[model samples]
Target chain A: MRLKMDFMGLSLKNPVMVAAGPWSRNPETIMRSLDAGASAVVTETIAMEVRQNVRPWIYSKNEGYQNVRLYSDHALEQWLIFIRQIKKEGGTVIASIMAHSPSEMAYIAKSVYKAGADAIELGLSIPHGEGVAVMGSDPDHMYNSVKRVIQSVDIPVMVKFSPHVTNISELAKVVEKAGASGISAIDTVRSIIGVDLETSKPLLATYGGYSGVPIKPIGLATVASIAQSVKIPVCGIGGISNWSDGLEYMMLGASTIQIGSAIMTLGSEVISDVIEGMDKWLEQKRLRAEGIVGKALSNLKSFDEIEILPYKAVLKDACPESSCETCVVGCLVGALEKKNGNIVYHQELCNGCGLCVSLCKDQNFELKWRL
Target chain B: MNIRDVAQRAGVSVATVSRVLNHPDQVTPKTRERILEIMKAMDYTPNWFARGLNLNRTGVIALLIPNIMNPIYTEIAKGVEEVAHNKGYYTLLCNSEDSKEKEAAYIEMLLHRKVDGLIFIAGHLDPDLMTRIEETRLPAVMIGKIEGNWQFSAVYTDYFEGARKATAHLIENGYSGIAHITGNLRFIESAEKLNGYREALKNADIQINPKWIIGGEETIEGGYLAAKRLVRNPNPPEAIFIANDWMAFGAIDAIKTEGFRIPEDIAVVGFDNNRMSGLVEPKLTTVNLPVYKMGLTASRLLFDEMDTLSSTSESDEKADQKQQIFLPLTIKVRNSCGHQDRIKAIFGE
Candidate 1:
């Protein structure tokens, strides 16, 4: 399987890159990820000034994760040294930087470029970084800031967009107009995570960035939208834990994939698993990554353009063997019922939405597209 | 009115007026009375900020705790309050709810208010907290144990030793099949207790069953759920050593729900001899951590540091050194571990 792809004008060994996060906070972890077959390691977001992180910064839920992490506490000089060392070791390095202004970003970008970074990643929308981080909502500011960094640095610059933007595609276009080499969408979603009902205090006591399996839809949507709008490559991020998710993003037009939450939750070993999964899938499909990229976009349809075919739920033989009534209880139109220890479908009441087909845990219901 | 206005009306020097406000007995009775009368006439209230600025002490300290609802912390807060009140100082109780942001905010607010000192009852020492305390040169003490060398004075019970003693007591009671229910291991204290439990089992030459040891949230529900899993095991332990009394209470409830009698079917011992420990049925046998005394000791340490800081221009050398006070733990023998039953048999029921 040919996994290599051109991301931001740089030839990557694979489409999988370790996104800028705690996993890439230190030289050791960055090396670990690169050794585990990550195409490139994006360093933890660095800024001109240092920010202190909260204790117990990472909180994991059943569905996703939440963190109050601000940015890299390492000094810019320390990171520059790390980047220089990594580049000397023949490892690809993409420096991630966060700044409030275009000048600060451009200055950091120039320093990073001198330090031997292959590319630059602009961190614009850290959830807790309201004033200090980039304003993803302001397109003009984003375009200007991205443009300034691109102009100052000779390396390829990828603008990371936040999910909080009203029109993510429009923001992607604004950055593309500024000559951004690629787009990484989406950054962690802004969330409060949860609350302690007993104390009436929020779990983190403040808003934090949320990531993991739950936010994959939001990520795919942003990637699909941005890929459709911009000419540059789309790096799908957020909630990508498995290779199938990586494949799904690639099919939706993301040329590259960034893994952050999965690495944080499952460890860096998942990087190899994801790469292997993507390779094995490509091998089975007898296709290269470029063939799959943007393949789904051609078939993509708007809500009104979708062809809604009429269908009806039909009970399968396994319905009697399993006592599960999930579909019966979940059916909104009262189309499904359990009668005489077997599922009975009322064809007359069924709207042919085929929700039961997905809800049935035992594969006890099937959707007949043409009744 | 300002102090100068009161001084002008009283026809006394500002020093005499200041003396009357602070050390009234030092001033002559007639002079003090005159100063007081004029001050009342001028509606004069000494400015708090100005007073604090002059003395370089706010007569106020702040206590930051991870959670207020926990009884252990509430007891510590009470002890701190008692010491602060006796010293003629007020304490600002700030609950961080285990959030570093909230803790940082509270520290910032206390610093802004010119608090004389701070007492932190944190599970873990946040690096930012230590950095801020050092940067400001503020007098502060911690009522917890954190890994590595830190500058702040700390007052904590030897949780490892306490847990070991608790587990050893259960062993002495002739229970070899012992299970340990620990608090969240993410915390240093919980990890220490778990180590202590393992050490005790190792000393007794009993094989440590990994399945017997369950990690739980430091709450009653966490204990209940952990205990539920333990009792449902094919080979449940004859005795269980819980990390804290709150969880022990929950474990006891869970064991009872499983139709097991205390100390007869399964014996249980807990750490932290909380007030309710004695009141609970079967009176939990537990390690008595001097939590209140820890609070009192920590506050005293902070006060002393504040005194040292104010008295000496060269206190930086002294403040750089770490001050640690390790409190001793005692085991409260009770019926939960079936020890009191032996005492009752030896004497009278």
Candidate 2:
């Protein structure tokens, strides 16, 4: 029963950590998260100036959270003090910092490394809006900025990217060439939580970053792309909630799992729960947690390389107890039909998409793969 | 029949026969004539692909144009094809329709087919396509302006200078109430043209009427609608400078339909001397963009780039060799701008 692993030369007791967010804002919370189970606590995004978040910034929708929160309000000197205190307590701290320009970014990276930080993670995900485009959105800008910071720092430099880009893998390759040690994806997706019925204004009052359960798939896809594109270690951070969600990211070739919105919604206890669940599952399987990383990459194939087996939907037997017509009405190809108070399957109309198979909870429809 | 057969029939070596077909002037007239006679007698035709294979080249260059329907691009295509044909290369024209996805797909397809080079005749800035081209390390030349920091060569016309000259002609004609119908301002070329118009009015000390300026789509209908709005104003302009010929054509039709005489009531000038500009009634007084010459230059530059890639070592600074060429523009004064009336009055009528 070993769960220890190595990511970007940092020894971690486990693969799960607190991603850069409000959860890792101060020294007390960082200490609490480290005590709870987080292997490494990524500090809240630190910038040159303290930011003032709008009132009522967080909006809760179904299974997701949209927030307009910005960088930490604490000054850079205060963050360095917090990092120094945490390092004195023997807790691994990954400092996350951002700035408006490359030189400014390099300056902050140097300051954080001097404060006894184990590593530096560059946060270049904020969209500038208006006429000023985000630095991460342009490859040349991102490459120059990353290079400047890496040149100024002695510690391993990691870059967390925004998902809203032309080609995520292409950007990943650009940053890798710029001497990044690892990559993290993705920042919260640009989203609008909801609109007020009375005033017709957005719930967050403006467009904001959306995170939580709904963004897990998007995060997994981005992480998989980045992992495959670069030789550096990858940190997956998106809609991860439970241990199973973290495991899914590991399977996609991520070396570590980062939980942000989930910790905000459920509290720091979520980190310990993830670590315990992963440990228990690995122990039951008689395997180490590190062994599961990148196991699914071997099965991953390009569209042209995938072997599509022919499958046809089949209905089990006519039952008088059948009262559900969900699959029949939900079939996109009209392959499922109701006749004589029972479901019937037309083999000719079936495209084998398996939509109806999931719709029928009575186990009436199943897509049998043709050998 | 192969060249060997012709050579044997003519009692000569195969090299002599090849020389006759390729460098006929270098060979003796007797040998060349004898080989030609035998080839004509045997009804033999030279293989185009075999000739290309001799140089280890594809002999095919792909040209991606934003729109094939636009006469400006078609004129460029014609120039490109003319040069390619003379250089023993075939031109593969792809109409991208100004879509980033379609341009990417075409670039992928062209790369797979092993084209010798690529020529992109885009109407707007294509940053994504430029990134894709850079990733593939392809020998390409663009026929439009790239605004950002890109490491590629481009050939462009000075839209700002062209607009300034077009507007200056109106001011020189004593028209103080000059207006402009601009193309979509989001594009750099359109914005440059608008700036040039402003500079011309500023140099002439004429106040620019903000209400007279209207942004229109780069289409005939956009021009027509924009002109309709302009003419509906309480005080319409005496002269208008349209961004492109297509929009100018539409503006002319709209002004005529509104019962305004061509040069007497409202003088109109357009940009991009389209082929139909001369055929339209009153003819179009437009700026000659030299699109065909630009296509020729871009194709030639791509060929030179491919040659540089083949000759130089991979470590050479060939990838960073980028050149920017700007061809000059001239205003084509026609009847639409009242220049013809001045000429006729000075001569006879």
Candidate 3:
């Protein structure tokens, strides 16, 4: 199974790194996560000054959790001290730097590297930074910011990019061109979780970064594009809750996986199970953690590049005398006809897209496989 | 020149001038134009303080519902509007369409419009909503919503008791095996109804067959398919207790299509005494829900809180605590659950 992995030039015991968030804010918290089986840990996005947070800074609903905590509240000196302590304890710590400008970011990067952090992760994806206005998505700002950190620090510099952009792949390429050692695909998208009809205001009222199980599809898509577009490794992070999610990220070419929200919800204990499950799965499939990286990338192709297959919907069960007529109506190709409930599959019309199969999977009009 | 001078110049009443200025829809186009022209000619300006004094009350309450198309929701809408009208308040009805995104957008727009209060017909209070309610300091009432043990200011019908009555009635009619059709058990109301069905069977000392309890979609088609499945089974139930009226209609149609005679072969009882209850061939026997009353009472609660909300000196954190309101339910027995004596009398004659 061999769970040992490497991110950039730094060798990691495993691929799982805790993303820079509230969980990784303090030295004590980061150390606790390391002890909980995280191969590497990222310090929460730290800036030059400590910012005071307001009451009720987080909102959650059926979709996801909206976080308004933009950056670390700890002073830069405090973070440098924490990094030194964590490094002395042999923790694979990655200091996260967020500053007002490239010069400030370069200064923080130099300080953290001097403090003996294994690496540094740039907070270039914050929707809104407390001290520094987030201009991370701007190509000029991202390039200048990453270039400063890269020139200042000898350690691997990973840039986490926000998904709130028109072309994330282009953004990833810009950071990579700036000499970023790796890319962390997806910072939370600015989202309004829900609204309080009672108050006539947005749930949080302010646009907040959203992350959870619901944001995985978009996050994975970002990871795939960045992995395919750039030469540097991609650290897939966003909506990763467990082992399966971690595996999915690696399969999509994430050399290292970062977890944030799942650890917050499931607690530090889930770290062990995730690593263990990944270990067991890799062994059961006779695969290595590094080998699985980009295994699914070959399958990630453009729409025009895909090869269409020919097949028709087949009926397995006895048809009803009178149907709800769901599959017949759902078929975009008009390949299905239901008289009463008697199904007549138009074999020639089927393209094997299997839209009807999904629609009728658990319904009265349970369509069979594409044959 | 002021608004008074404009009214004098236009040969119209001051009220007409005010109406054209504030409430233009109430003024005819001809009168509105004349007043505007007179004001322009006189260079008349309404006193800023006087305008504030005129439209003192915002008097707008946002009523957010899951779907306006749902008959039950429409009834609740009528109820909210009726009560709001009595209070000299206008209800801004917004259909969230059961989506959290749409709900959030409407809530923001309504809040920006300075709604005096809000009423949500939500089954679950999103934690985000809870925070927004706290931050805005607006009096809000929830209608027919409950999540876990946390009770909100909700007006929900006693679905369990109503369902128990329906099931008990079928038991009383000498129907041994009774099947209950319901929406997904994820919903609090649906689960409550199911529990009532189970309890009724338990009280009657009859074994509850798991297979007979069909979990169907909350639609007419779902009910039809589920009813067909139940009837085609080897040991079919003699009577059915459908959770809602719309689905009950479908079930009745399915039963008829299956060549079953009402009461003689099978008996059916539905919930929600909707308009279509009496329109069908054999009228539906159902649980009469206080739809209008639920909405009316919930709105009344919001109105009462609106008083305290307006006078913030009296309200504190405790004022935001949710209050749960449970309304009573009654059975509306019709021809669908055909009385044996009545059926016999009709056929015998």
Each candidate: what lDDT?
A: 0.82, 0.81, 0.78
Classify candidate 1 by CAPRI docking class.
incorrect
TM-score of 2: 0.52
What interface root-mean-square deviation (Å) does model 3 yield? 34.3
lDDT of 2 by residue, A253-358 (tens): 8989998888777888999999999999889888887898888887889999977889888777674446767887798999777777776767888888988778
Q: Model 2, B95-201: lDDT tens per residue?
A: 98777788878988988877888888645535776787767778888887756776667777789999999998888877889899999887777889999999999
DockQ of each two-chain model: 0.01, 0.01, 0.01
Name the weakest run of 10 consecutive residues (lDDT summed) in model 1 chain B.
B340-349
The per-residue C-alpha lDDT of model 2 at residue A253 equals 84
| Model 2: lDDT of residue B287 | 87
The order of the candidates by lDDT, greatest first, is: 1, 2, 3
What's the CA RMSD of model 2 in angstroms? 27.6
lDDT of 3 at A50: 53
lDDT of 2 at B172: 80
The CA lDDT at A366 in model 2 is 74
| TM-score versus the correct structure, for each prediction | 0.52, 0.52, 0.48
Q: DockQ score of candidate 3?
A: 0.01
lDDT of 3 by residue, B276-327 (tens): 8878868888887878767766776686577544545753325555555555
